[model samples]
Target: MTTNILINRRSIQILRILVSGIFLVAGLNHLLNVEKTAQRIEQANFKGIAYFFGEPQWLIILSGIVMLSAGFLFLIGYKTKWAAIILMAVLIPITLTVQVGQITSLGPLFKNIAILGGLLFFILNDTEKKLI
Candidate 1:
């Protein structure tokens, strides 16, 4: 029983770290490469939404802030549900703008879908019990 519990704890910890890592890295990229990221956003199929938010650079900075903050919270298993919710909120528009409607981007689209599933897991379940 103890061994099983240990395994489950480790599994959840690993999963949490992996899930949060993607956002952390992406957040850093947006923060560090605002112009390039903005250019990518501008070139996306649904870039109008990016413009709707404001200048693409500003949007990218906002996104980076949200992702870094929420990603850290999620990684540390603090306020995880809210963190997941925030991440999902940011991800939908990004997925739609950059990944959707492009045949070549199917892989990234599916990857984002899977990431959504991971975030949904945190939102729907109290993983805190198993996390510690």
Candidate 2:
């Protein structure tokens, strides 16, 4: 008789770290392509804080840095709650202002929602560190 094992705690933590790596890569891409990211911001019409930042490009770059640092912190299990919160600060606005357009835009919207769920998981649980 054999029994199938579902996810153990180690597996969950590994999954969490792997997921965070995706944000790390995405954030790096944003920082690397500041011009393109700025163009996207302009196309999205997300200019509520343009006046405060003097340029939407700066805001975009700032968000990219936040995401990059947050992903690293989360992966390393250092101040993870704070990292998740900071990442959410960037994500929520972009999701609402940028992705919340038509109903057909469910793909990216749901993807972000799932990522938010993962961050919340990290926020609620203090998993043991493996590679930290």
Best by lDDT: 1
Cα lDDT of model 1 by residue, 39-78, tens digit: 8887788888778778888889999999999999989989
Assess the local accuracy of residue 125 in candidate 1 as a C-alpha lDDT between 0 and 100. Answer: 71
* lDDT of candidate 2 at residue 44, scale 0 to 100: 59
Tell me how many clashing residue pairs each candidate has.
Answer: 0, 0
Our model 2 lands, by Cα RMSD against the true structure, at 5.8
RMSD of each: 4.0, 5.8
User: Clashing pairs in model 2?
Assistant: none
Estimate, for each residue in 1-132, the C-alpha lDDT of model 2 and write its tens digit: 665344476666686688688679878987899888766656554445444446766776787788889889888877877887887777887776556663666798888899888877767655544423
Please give the TM-score that candidate 2 achieves against the real structure.
Answer: 0.77
Instruction: Give the TM-scores of the predictions, in the order they appear.
Output: 0.89, 0.77
Q: Lowest-scoring 10 consecutive residues by lDDT in candidate 2?
A: 44-53
Q: Which 10 consecutive positions of candidate 1 have the poorest summed lDDT?
A: 1-10
Residue 36 of candidate 2: its Cα lDDT?
Answer: 85
